[model samples]
Target: MATRPLTGTKVFLILVAFFGVVIGVNVTMMKLAIATLPGTDVDSPYAAGLAYDREISAAQDQASRKWQVNAHIERRADGNAVLQVEARDASGQPLTGLKFAGRLERPTDKRADLAVGLAEAGIGIYRGNAASVAPGQWDLVIEGDAKGERVFLSRNRVILN
Candidate 1:
């Protein structure tokens, strides 16, 4: 048999040493790159990006807790938009005799008050006609004062169409 130049054990050791050197060199290069970068909010730019991401997440969480009244837009067959207001107490119980101020805002930047013909048929529903409103996305803001406190409900972004 021909003499083997390198034993299997020797080949395995050489491969392990080569990989170890490669890994060490790669780690050193990464450290050097990090050291050369500017020292701002964090040593690495990725850490700064993570900090911004956390701030955005916190803001979103805060926004979700906002106590805004919930309502829906109803469109009429005559192409006019109708604004419906629902009055509720702090405990979410429907309240009657709630004097509300409803405003319907159209896409043309025109606004009209829908509080004139408001009728309360049930415990907490107030209905009014907004004939000036068109069949598109609209903004409905309703305000009311009951008991001893003033309540403000703004459905800032609503779709009428």
Candidate 2:
């Protein structure tokens, strides 16, 4: 059998092919990563930082109020979730005339968050429903507003089967 020597052209082609595959794979991976990435938690980090003091004061006020808030969530068979909230004062009297809202937030994906508008079902009792709630881990955020001011805020982690 006759043997041919390794030529400069062959070496150049081999090097180009090797680096081409590596670069191609890297570009594909980068595109996939950017496409799948969920954006920042807050739209403006600077603004959020500026509001840190207000959040702290609000939390202190909520604590001082010593309000009693209870939340119940039930996932129905039809992929909908029912949320019920009951608010009471420290003395156990029902709290009235307050607007309540709830959110089911996906910890990993902000786009999957579901907002629920709660209406007064009875004294101190509020009820809301969210459609097509996927069964998984979630952050349940409940907020209460009085006279257009945020008076209560709570976030609890929950899992649904």
Candidate 3:
């Protein structure tokens, strides 16, 4: 059987089909990536940058208070998560009688975010519990206040293992 090959039409058709498939795949991937974006932390980057000085001043204000805050997580066997928080002063004295609260924020998905609070456990120590938190990375944003004003703020990343 003799075969005739290298026809112009065949070559053109094959090249067109190859490029078409490549374009289709690229479009699909691009759409998926855009659809699954984690999210934006700020609404306006330019505005946020412009306000950077204010943020710095606020942080400096907090630092001036000389309050030290430490926080961590403990994952239990029953799939529950516990958040432990402790606060003190520069002189190592416990900062008691302050309000403390936090949130379990999913790194990528807001749907899985959880609000957790740390009630007073001991002198300067606070604890809170979440019934069931998915095992993964979680950002813990904690705030402490005294006399209805913010005193300390901290953001820590922890893994639920």
Candidate 4:
């Protein structure tokens, strides 16, 4: 039996029809699934639990005085690093009478503990010198009081290079 060749139009029409049915079914199923799904309130129990966990962690940090210390480092052209630290309140304002001590620490090596105290450089700026810190990572610790209360804090892993 002789068979006529299928035209390009016939193939295109078949492909279009097949894709149309698939797309129609997908759209219908998507609509039905969305309509049947339960609404999730963002302030639900699960969300509240997450928020509570975050609050607890923050409270723990505050109790440990970890939130009081803010530390940073700047490198110079002489391969030396200037570790800058400013004691601050929770609102990030510089606090006076805060003592800061830092250390250049490396794993499996001797740690160099630097003794530095906050000095009034200018208006609301406190600076402490770190002579032992070089171009690498180090830790700067600031410990003192806002208004005669104990504040123990430490900052870690500041990159200088």
RMSD, each candidate, Å?
A: 16.6, 1.2, 2.5, 14.8
lDDT of 2 by residue, 1-161 (tens): 99999999999999999999999999999999999999999999999999999999999999999999999999998999999999999999999999999999999999899999999999999999999999999999999999999999999999976
For residues 36-80, could you state the per-residue lDDT of candidate 3 as single tens digits? 886787789999999999878878999897877888788899988
- CA displacement after TM-score superposition, residue 3 of candidate 4 (Å): 92
Report the lDDT tens digits of candidate 1 across residue range 1-161. Answer: 89878889999999999999999999999999887654443368887787898657755653564533456567777866555667665567777766666676543434233432556766788776767555566667666655654444454767766
Determine which window of 10 residues in candidate 1 has minimal summed lDDT: 107-116
Candidate lDDT (C-alpha), each: 0.64, 0.97, 0.88, 0.60
TM-score of each candidate?
Answer: 0.46, 0.95, 0.80, 0.44
Candidate 3 global lDDT: 0.88
Best by TM-score: 2
CA RMSD (A), model 2? 1.2
Worst 10 residues of 2 by lDDT: 152-161
How are the candidates ranked when ordered by TM-score, highest leading?
A: 2, 3, 1, 4
Stretches off by above 4 angstroms in model 1 are 1-68, 111-117, 147-149
| Model 3 ranges off by over 4 Å | 90-93, 106-112
